[model samples]
Target: LPWHTTGKLSTNRVTSSCSRRAMPELLQFKDASSMRKYSRLQRQAGKRIALVPTMGYLHAGHMSLVQAATDRADIVIASIYVNPTQFSRNEDFGVYPKAREEDHRKLLAAGCAAVFEPASLYHPGTVSSDGAGDNANVVGAGEHVVGAHETFIQVEQLQKGLCGVSRPHFFRGVATIVAKLFNIVEPDVAVFGKKDYQQWRVICRMVRDLDFDVEVVGVATGREEDGMAMSSRNALLTPDNRQRAVCISQALKWAEEQISHREATPSGIQHEVTDRISTGGGRVDYVSVTDAENLQELKHFVSGQEVLVAVAAFFGSVRLIDNVVSVKQAG
Candidate 1:
């Protein structure tokens, strides 16, 4: 394995296997400049690169993204930076679960070619410490300082509803960091899990509108056997809260069913989902029925048009989100 930290590169050997062939050593890069240079070299060699950007708590959901990227390109680079800009002042950035060595092991086993683990994309010359806990002082949405990163990217219309309504600063941070990754990695394609439906749509719209020459691929959301969507925050759930969290997926499925049968209005479905989650011991953040493509909240269902039923709820302080898309059929 090769680890690039503070613009210095060190190599180590790791044995791994992939479906295509015996995998090469896993490489790690901690700085933007080194990764950019490596990406340029790969591009010059006529290799197709795919990027799977993650926050570094590797779970099955993230590995699915890596597999999706591996299937598409010759080289797969997974970036494991827990973006500080995305977190709000009161958010869980400080306590965000991090397992760097374990994450590296999983990516190595999944046959990822390289890991871009930049410490501070916004602050030049800032190096990452061993864990996310040490980087607690990294600036977030409103915590700007003199000579700190001030620029942010926002997809105006798409980021207005759903999760945006609650975590207003979130999508801007996501869009900005992702744009920086697209520029740094310059991958031929990028993979994102569709669990965050609004975020996926936001990134797609950003790529299209900004004219970034990268293909954005959305993989289906990975779920647990009990129907709960996989998330890093799931680790924070108490035993009781974990059980309660399943209602999010259950509500989404019920909403999808209602849409398919045309048995309820969009508002009716939203209210029902919210009530179900609340009854299940979770605090309802929002339940929205919106146009799947544009994310405009829908008041009436249109046959043959896809609408998304998305929800975000708090299960004992751990917020979980899940969504489902369905199209009504003409009678």
Candidate 2:
């Protein structure tokens, strides 16, 4: 296959034609069975495998995850499937953006061992009206596709708050699809972004409780020059909305400052963040301060308890989420 040379190397990193040899060949897989076959072969040969799950439309944030996988395993498999189960009906699932060509280029440039672009995995039967057609030969990644499968994985209590408040069914979709990926890929390790802090904790809990042998790694969130966490949805932001979106990170920074200064209580910090984001011309979804480990809602600041201050808001049509977590210590 043709490799992508268009991706620019980040500052402090050297790029040259010879460096490409250090990167593995970018193989493409369109179904679980084929990808699993390769995984089985790798396991038999005593090679370690690392998996990075993602919806297509790769960015620098995704490349960071891929890089983490490469550092840990002999082979890196990145799955690009836009799971319909994770998106609510009113959410923008249909138009979430699928740049397979560009994503392929980026993955190739990032030295991914294989790209699993399954049509649909969980939905096995004919396609449902959710846009997945009935003609799919095998089970693939398609929304609204009819399938006999009804089993879903959920991390009780954890999914009840935070981003889950607005999108109730979102985590169910995420947990179920992720379980499926872990089963099919059977990776020795998996990497996820901490931008979705709650989701990361949820996956970590699920892995531990389910007894999956795979190691779950949380890579730090990747941000743009302006401090906005990079996401596929960033493309949906209009020019002015994009500028206004910077307030999300700004509010986070302000909350961090308040924590450092010991000037604001948990609720006060939450209200201040809500006000700042709202005053910045964005609609607030939820501004919360909770225990980072258990996500229990915090009433007042408690020393030694790790607290997570997370925010989700709408900048125009785009819903943005960011968080800051730290151990509360006595000043």
**All candidates' TM-scores?**
0.90, 0.88
Q: Following a full C-alpha superposition, what root-mean-square deviation does model 1 have from the true structure?
A: 3.8
Best candidate, TM-score: 1
Writing each residue's lDDT as its tens digit, candidate 2 over 12-66 gives 1123244656744567777677677778778888889999999978899999999
Worst 10 residues of 2 by lDDT: 5-14
**Residue range 1-331, candidate 1, lDDT tens digits:** 2323333444333445553573457777777877888887778888899999999888999999999999999889999888877777678887999998889889988869888987678752244333344254344423334454568899999999999888888899899999999999999999999999999999999999999999999999999999999999999999989998898899889888888885678889989999999999999989989999999988888889898998989988888888998998774
Candidate 1 regions exceeding 4 Å error are 1-23, 124-143
Among all candidates shown, the one with the greatest lDDT: 1
- Judge candidate 1 at residue 11 and give its lDDT: 31
Query: Positional deviation of 270 in candidate 1, in angstroms?
Result: 0.5
- Compared with the true structure, all predictions reach lDDT values of 0.84, 0.81
